[model samples]
Target: MTLSRDKAIIGAMEILSELIIIALLSIAGGVIAAMLPFAFPPAVISLFLLLLLLFLGIIKEDGLSSSSSFFLKYMAMFFVPSGVEIIEYADLLSSSWFHIILISAISMLITFFAAAKAVEITERLMQRRKAA
Candidate 1:
């Protein structure tokens, strides 16, 4: 009983620490974004900073694994607010429904084409490497 209790406590602490690290990085990203001359989303800046840290070996994947898993587990919850906002702005969305659908369709096609080309390039590169 004691052993299981201790393990639970340790696991909770680990998740807390991982969340703190992510929060600090996000705050730092916000500050950096504010200091920039051009308008840029702070969240994108945060993601880029996190990527840089990982690439530089300043942060290990294992360090964030728990928090990342937690986020993924509750990912649907994250979209709840967006859904609520859409409901709140249903009138505006209805008014622009046609434009929204057109833009969404165009963007989806562009994204699909880009992803297909990327995969083709990657496969060709891999095949060449195997041949070499």
Candidate 2:
């Protein structure tokens, strides 16, 4: 089904409203983190705020539907901070290139084996269940 112009406008408004509320809540969480002595990463703070909202029933699954996809899709927009900081410390990363490469290779191999084992175990279990 196609969304008519009026329906599209309404949908856009609803999405905007959801986004404004989420953004305000996130900002509030950030403010709380700033007030506390211990540092909480923004990601953790936002997650905690989301959990609280979910538990309090202020926001439910519907509120986090396709509308939330906009924020999620653009989340990489916030990655500039990480990129800048990493670039600033590029020398340190360069110094550990060999170690990083070794760790990556080992991790890749381990992940491949674990995934293969998981698939085999799951298929066997499913087959047994089907037989029963």
Candidate 3:
């Protein structure tokens, strides 16, 4: 019983530490966004910062694996607030539903085309490398 309790405490501490690391990165990102001239989302800045850290070997995937997994496990919960907001604005959305749908469709198609071309270019480059 004592051994299991110790393991549980260690596990909880690890998760807490991982969460602190993510929170610190988010705070740093907010500071950077505030210093920038243009408007940008702090969350996006945080993600980019995290990506840079990972690429530069300053942070390891293992360090974030548990926290990331925990987030993914409850990802749907994150969307709940958005869903509530949409419901709150249902009348406005209903009025502009067609225009909203049209824009969404057009943007989705453009994104798909862009992604397809990128993949094609990447494949060609890979093939060329193999041939060389």
Q: What does each candidate score in C-alpha RMSD?
A: 3.0, 5.6, 2.5
Best by TM-score: 3
Q: Write the per-residue lDDT of candidate 1 for residues 85-113, one digit (tens) a residue.
A: 88888899989999999999999999999
TM-scores of the models, in the given order?
Answer: 0.78, 0.60, 0.81
Q: Candidates 1 and 2: which is better by lDDT? A: 1
Candidate 2: tens digits of C-alpha lDDT, residues 20-131: 8778877888888898899887657877888888899988868778656766889888888888788777898999989999999999999999999999999999999999
For candidate 2, list the clashing residue pairs, or say none. Answer: none
Name model 1 segments beyond 4 Å from true: 114-132
TM-score of 3: 0.81
- Looking at model 3, the pairs that clash are none
Off by over 4 Å in 3: 121-132
lDDT of each: 0.93, 0.85, 0.94
lDDT preference between candidates 1 and 3, better one = 3
* TM-score of predicted structure 2: 0.60
For model 2 the local lDDT of residue 129 reads 100
Question: C-alpha displacement of 52 in model 1, angstroms?
Answer: 2.1
Find the 10 residues in a row with the least total lDDT in model 1: 81-90
RMSD of 2: 5.6
